[model samples]
Target: MPFAVYVLGLAVFAQGTSEFMLSGLVSSIAADLGVPLSAAGLLTSAFAVGMVIGAPLMALFSRTWPRRRALLFFLAVFVAVHIAGALTPGYGVLLATRFVGAIANAGFWAVALTAAVAMVPDRLKGRATAVVVGGVTIACVVGVPAGAVLGERWGWRAAFWAVAAVSLPAFLAILRSVPGGPRPEAVPAPVSVRDELRVLTGPRLRPTLLTMALVQGATFCAFSYLEPLLTRATGLGAARVPAALALFGAGAFLGVTAAGRYAERWPTAFVTYGMAALALGWSALALTAARPLAVLALIPLLGMLAFGTGTALITRVLALAPGAPTLAGAFSTSAFNLGAAVGPWAGGLALDAGLGHRAPVWVSAVLMASALAVAGVRRADGTVSGVRVT
Candidate 1:
């Protein structure tokens, strides 16, 4: 409900949209740039690699700045990076620009997650985090679809340009509406690096991170190559890809809101059930492409389940490492980007092998199944104190 939370959410929305819209546009970009689609998709990995590297770096460097300034600076970088991505002369240049944008993204999410928790009342932090984090969910629903449509109608370059255009206003919104750095201390700043390691390496932190890797990886594995998957499997045209993306995004939005509302009562089981649902939905999705309508119908349900797990996961981490929530949140964000990086890279291998289109989705189902197993393992221990991670 606070203005800061809303602006934080908008920043996330822009980042999330940029992160995902590429899937819908990859095919077109590949064609435009005279490259393979697999190679085009690799740009996502390049960006993700930037995030993976930038996460800890931002955590280490930005800890000293006023949190609000750190965020605004990143948004400025984000706008610059997207503009570069749009105007680049070659595919390689585009990837480099996106990589820089990805670094900005890492800072945005890291700060946004920590700020959301600090800005809200203790009892409401979970929901507040969800509201802020839901930017990604909304991105899945609106940003991806819209970007894809724009790319299809105009060109993929248009998508990146649009993302850059949005960043200016988002930056202005944060600057005007959010309080600056040296805001209230969320908690006593610990001995920055040492305390961060202690909390991150502590008991609750390890498994929760593992859980995040599995769940987030599984989602990316299926989703990174999703446009090709649907096109190949369902014989859908380029124009329809955005609509399919919209379906998945719609489902995720529902899943996030629903999970956030209920997660406080039974965090572990909620994640457990959500993982189970993801496996089922992914399995169903992989096989249902022959029935395109049915496949499209199921995407939202899949998104709802696959993406909703974050609400409980982040809340759990904050609970376990109350004093060290920022680093924990950073780790989780890194895990998601790591997953994003790996999914497409691995899927590209399978795709390169001349495997049919459904391979990535099928592999994603297996990944989801593995994620479920990991969730069960965490549940069995009952030692998980902080976040659920995935």
Candidate 2:
């Protein structure tokens, strides 16, 4: 792997920290902003909505810009919004900042994913995706738990400031390591934006995109409420939540690592068994929510299955949309974040309906089951319709 791939991963770590940290900080944010918990949870949804809308739009608008330049520009906007979010006193102002920051973050993902894939050979695509997506797992492992501690000790604003501080180095690293030149040959040659858009909508790609959204939605439905589920329903102490989160992230890191090795060879298996296992895990989690030991044991397992499956689905999207890497990145990013948005909102509805914290876990299981059903569809030849898993 090129040193630049790691640099992009480092930048993703900074961005992903902010993206995932909100889950740990939601309670603190709700109290500080004098809003209901459900309202505070909407911050995550707002960010997801921004990503869903911004990815393709930003990709198209910045399509002609130098890759390095586009990345830096997006990172700068991301950092600036974190600072603004940290300083804002009103909840509306903070929410607006999150939305804008997500747009910037989505743009960065669009450019950076294309750049990372273009840097590697076809055989190494899965490994490259793992290296980039590993940043998110690491954020979940380190940055999110750290943010939780910071929010508990200081305020949620401190976590926002820390995200901005961490991102500055990424901005510098990207500036130094990523090239500012003509596009690499590994990238699909330039095509009309219309043509790229057409490829994105092709029959072969639609199911992959739908699967992306459903799988992600399923994973996040439980994840968004993990802290409350652990602290409130499982009888775990507040201090232990961070450790559980770390364990979950560790599982995700391991899953991504494993997927890098086997996903390309067995993408179908990854998607099929992974989602089925996730559904079972969440169902078990809901059933065992009151048992601290069982809850602790399951978190890491579910995290591993969820992310490993996600990495494979991503590899599939890229394969399906070979002619439009940037648009593919944008659309895949949108699909995942679309799930991110809906998952939390669905979880919130469960909470609002007087369902216990365990309700979201059941919701996750149902969502994953739906994802599995989508992925299970096959042709007469016993292969997935329009998909040739390599």
Candidate number achieving the greatest lDDT relative to the actual structure: 2
Instruction: Quote the positional error of residue 85 for candidate 2 in Å.
Output: 2.1
Compute each candidate's TM-score over C-alphas. 0.89, 0.92
Model 1 vs. true fold: TM: 0.89
Per-residue error for 14 in candidate 2, Å, reads: 1.3
lDDT of 2 by residue, 1-390 (tens): 988888888888988899988877989888888999989978987888899999999998788778999999999999999999999889999999999999999999888888888888988888888888889999999988788789989999999999999888888888888888866532456677888888988766777788889888888888888989999999888888878988999999999988888898887777788888998999999999999999899999989998998988887888778788569889988998899888877988999999888998889888888886766563222353544533
Q: What tens digits encode model 1's per-residue C-alpha lDDT throughout 64-165? A: 677779889889989988888788769888878888888889988887888777877777777777787789888887888789779979999999888888
lDDT of each: 0.78, 0.86
